[model samples]
Target: MRGIADIFGKEWATPSAVETLMRQNKPKGFMCVSCSWAKPADYHTFEFCENGAKATLWELTSKRCTPEFFAAHSVTELRGWSDYDLEQQGRLTDPMRYDPATDHYVPCSWEEAFQGIGAQLRALDPKSVIFYASGRASLETSYLYALFARLYGNNNIPDSSNMCHETTGVALNKVIGVGVGTVVFDDLAKCDAFFFFGQNTGSNSPRFLHPLQEAAKRGVPIITFNPVREKGLESFINPQNVTEMLTGKATPISTQYHQVKVGGDIAVLIGLCKHVFACDDAAKRDGRRVLDVDFIEAHTKGLDEFEAKVRATSWNEIEAASGLTRAAIEGAGQVYVEADRVIGIYGMGLTQHVHGFENVATFVNLLLLKGNIGRDGTGISPVRGHSNVQGQRTVGIADKPKLVPLDRLAEQFGFEPPREKGMNTVEACHGMIDGKVKAFIGLGGNFVRAIPERAAMEQAWTRMELTVQIATKLNRSHLVNGKAAYLLPCLGRTEQDIQATGPQAVTMEDTFSCIQGSVGLRTPASDNLKSELAIVAGIAKATLPPNPKVIWDDWVGDYGLVRDAIEHTYPDMFHDFNARMFTPGGFYKGNAARERIWNTESGKAEFTTPTMLSSIGFDDAPGRYRLLTMRSNDQFNTTIYGMSDRLRGIEGRRDVLLINPDDIARAGLVDGQMVWLVGDADDGVHREVGPLKVTPFRLPDGCVGSYYPEMNPLIALDHHDIESKTPANKSVPVKIRA
Candidate 1:
């Protein structure tokens, strides 16, 4: 019951805990600030999962980072603390400014912080400033942040998407003419079968298991493909169901689980398509009409080229690359062929790779082959990370502005918005390192720890003229200060958002484009903490020239004004933004692909063939293993709740490496033995992070798993997906060495 004790110890007695439960469990209350998994309309009494509760408790802790707390701790002293230690220091109660002389963060007034930020921003060319967004920002806050960036004459709005779902957006846009998933939340219940690729929905999105369990109970087959078997997907006991919780009976989730090798998603998809093509030829010879010939001829292009590419690929190549037998692939292929409505669900496992764009394209090609697009129970679904990461993109947050209506924004906001694409997350880091970026403002997220090459980026961040973080709690990002760095504390999603007009409720869009209203019912953590809207407006007011062009003050007082601006900006989708958000389950931003209407240059869904499956294994380098970075069951992204990862059978440790027994033997290492991991580099600069105890785990040979941020140092900044600009965190070349 250590798990139960943590819930009660860190949270039970606190006022924040009581308030959090009231706000979270209330019918149609604020959305959980955890994963982006969609929830059903008939909300349960307790809507939160274990991680969601931890996220809330951690955010709403009674412990406060008062001015006195900062006075005692120098930046130098704090730098020695771990991520968990830093977060445990509690909520930032006031605005702070880094004093270089003392090497400490001294308390500063909100006005002083905003004006200083504005002055620094005004001093630089807009092109040199990067306005970054995190998934935590509400729709209103992100929309305002984007507008502020564009009005300031730059579109350098890099967001968390550049790190996670950019590949899904790029790939889906190319083939389906839509950047988001075509399937709705209800489709989970309707789909005949699900083909899960590279996503561990169990730990990442525990709420998602409700649908998976229901579907499994209904005898709907779920095929899972990942490097390691996740317990949540294999069998789950819903904590909400008293009978299941008390009886200790677990529900089986996946009918078939294939341990695909590292970076093997594309090969597996290609192999499945190859088998499908063979079956199609056989059926056509017997006049059985297996392939969706009419749909393919009418609604798609480049099929002949794609078909030839699949047919030419050999089974030996598929087996060697995917680490799956030909019979196994054919069995999955047969399942796909037999299922009338198939939904393909994938996550970062398939996206964070050199061939991420091609990986997603391969899955889309499979869905399109069977006339799955536009069908009720059939389509592509990318399980997005972060609650409103997708919403941030929807409301105009991007380095390269894709799908944003510039003409509409210009007409509504009375300013010529920047048309040139800006720096993405990786590009922004590089820009900072090269001195090209002068100022940086992050709405939320721990940028330093979240990005690769933390050591290099940490040093690069010191050179910036201005660095501002608008956040709720203390994180590692605040420690890496620029010349004029400021930390502006904002109200948490659980707290009340009271403006001049009265209480305000923000909005957010989930993974599938469902917009939900979020209103915080709890009192603010501190009276000094301001809402994100107020903070953005304050900076905009201080920076922008005084004019009636945009009523910044008015928008701050009333969020409905911001919603009005949003509706005025995107009249088609966000029409009646406020009214639509009030609907029982909120509104669904309809996708063009869902209607089978392709808005592509070809006016149809395009079938593109990958050149060739890239090699995953290192035959020449026998001692090296392909490292796949992942989060523990107790963690969410960069936030570490505790040292234990109960789901993986790991306890009281964060540095242990999960390796296959065969790989351990091959590396001349014993289970439970310690070893250092030396990264393989082509640029003559290598990083080593280890002395980590090796734990024997079930995984494909030559593949090992480790928690992210710890393994982030091993990743080179240069190693990334060119099309999506996402870091290739899943397949890092590393070796077990002394």
Candidate 2:
């Protein structure tokens, strides 16, 4: 009903919506922009979820945020509008530049906008310019964006990965030599058990529920550990399942759902390892095999040190840190021990923390004990949120110099690419605040709204000499304009992107490493709007000096040429890029860990010993509570589709906090009472989000839940993982005030 209403409410044509729905996730059709979840090889007629429908309808909306709209509304007035309201204004129909004198955005030609931005770039040091790409961009666009950044002289290419799963890459690269998940969609069918930690699968990727439902029907144990008992984790009635929907029979998801406190993942993981070790010890005495001794001896290292640390840790300490009883931990461990094959899955809940690297490493440690990697049904799976986030990284959108093959890129592009390590999301924010970064260019996202320390970021953002945003709609980031800001509207994933070589199809990699083609079907909202590829090429043409070695126009004209360049840069992975992309269901970019080929320094999977038992050291003060920022069902990252959070029973309101009943009473707070959440970061920043209604939820004591991006303010910019520098958004210290 929500999907239908959203389609009609957006004033999108019914026939267009139907056609889009039919084509979404199809072999030759466009990919859904909602999530990175992989589409099945044998796909159903309707492959998209409700959220996917919302994402499609969102792009297909008939309303337009024309130059006239901006002319009527001043930037100051638009700043007061909600994120939903700003986006609701509709598709950006023209290239607009901020006019400080009039305090409004005035329409400008694409040529003028590109030239002005180019002139600004030429005036500043290329190192000071920041190139930010959102996950929604296609592989072709991202490749061009990265090339443009390097050709202009710096590698300050930071994408959405730095904020979400930077830790996954950092941790997995150190331990297993592969940054991406080893498990493919087929693994779900082969695995005997599934263990989900910290991820709220339902809200993030509803399409994933189908596999879990199938696993449930097979009686496969689906164990879950999270702060919130997400409704999706409990049960889900597949909307497509006619009989089940009619009978109101929902498929059970998690067989055992443990409510681990915020920052308790490491403790629980260690506890599970301890139980496995104890069982192995007893089995050894009975001359029975409990551990995969042969696989461990052949394929793994550092088990001695890792096992010693787990054995040294006491049950009392584990219980205290995990907010779970010893018996419960052992019970979960028993399931892990019994299963022949297990797929350990996690999301941002594990990565967005001060000890995010350690959390991921610890999970890997547990999997290693049973020889989980390199097997058919077993591996580590980090569920990515954005559609092309992983693909962006694969095709060279990285801050770190070593992550990208600079030597190969230099050889392929005929230019000396920058060797200096550029800024990640955190460093970029700090650079802006420190008055070092001068220019900011965003491909497709609300940078100012999605990042942390919003107030500081916005203020620092204004200080930048130039800011360029290539987007589909008006966002808060556009409102927080730089000194010389330009908004270049681009065609969305749902719209046709015709080039000189006819219609083009771009590729995207899913969470499972499957690369599939996505081509738009709907007519573009505006003829003035250019494709992301064209916009990037325009910027490059205007910014860089004339060079025959790099032909920007040719690549933009034929994306296959871009694919050929990508293939040349990464021959092993994208060997037959253009040909393979046209293949039905696309191709799988194989993982090194799956083939037992570890590209690490040790030449084998190594177990890591965590120094800390928990991600955050709780103060245990009277008023202190750990904050877990989450996305409502109606929201995707910073984009709020609707006001209501259907799964959580939140109706027409985002200003509400979910707290345990015990904590509500303990903090002297009553249900439905409006209260202030003051930050306890102790960093001298006055961070507080106000008058939120306290709603009782089934969470562990000393832990509370609230919507993300809204509560992103409470998270200090500096409070992040030392290794990965991913923001510690999952575990923030806060206090409640009436």
Best by lDDT: 2
For candidate 2, what is the TM-score? 0.99
Q: Taking the tens digit of each residue's C-alpha lDDT, what string does model 1 give over 1-738?
A: 345358557643375575566556233578889888775577776777777777777776777888898899998788889988888777888999999999999999988988888888888999999999889899998899999998898889988988888988888998989899999988888999999998988778888898899999999999999998999889989888999989999999999999999888888999999888888888988888667888999899988899899989999988988899999999999999989999999999988987889999989899888998898999999999898999999889987765688888887767788898888898898998899998889998998999998888999999999889998878888888898889999999988899888999988988878888888877787999999989999999889887576888898899998999888888888998987786766689899999999988899999989875752322426676799898988788898888878888999998888988887777778888888887885667778898799999999998888889899988888878768878989888888874
In candidate 2, what are the lDDT values of residues 1-738, reduced to their tens digit?
565476457655446788888999988899999899987778987898877888888888888999999889999999999998999888899999999999999999999999999999999999899999999999999988998998888889989988999999999999999999999989989999999998988889988999899999999999999988899999999888899979999988999999998999999999999999889999999998779999899989999998889889999999999999999999999999999999999999899888999999999988988999889999999999999999999999998888889999888777899898888899999999999999999999998988888888988999999999999988999988889999999999989989999999999999999899988999999989999999999988898998887888998889999999999998889999998995666688788999989999999899999988789744567778899998988878999888878788888898988998888887788999999899998778899998899998888888898988899888889888878888888988998879
Task: Point out the worst 10-residue segment of candidate 1 by lDDT.
Answer: 614-623
Candidate 1: RMSD to truth = 1.6
- The C-alpha lDDT values of all candidates are 0.86, 0.90
The regions of model 2 sitting more than 4 angstroms off are 11-14
Best by the TM-score measure:
2
Candidates' TM-scores? 0.98, 0.99
The collision pairs in model 2 are: none
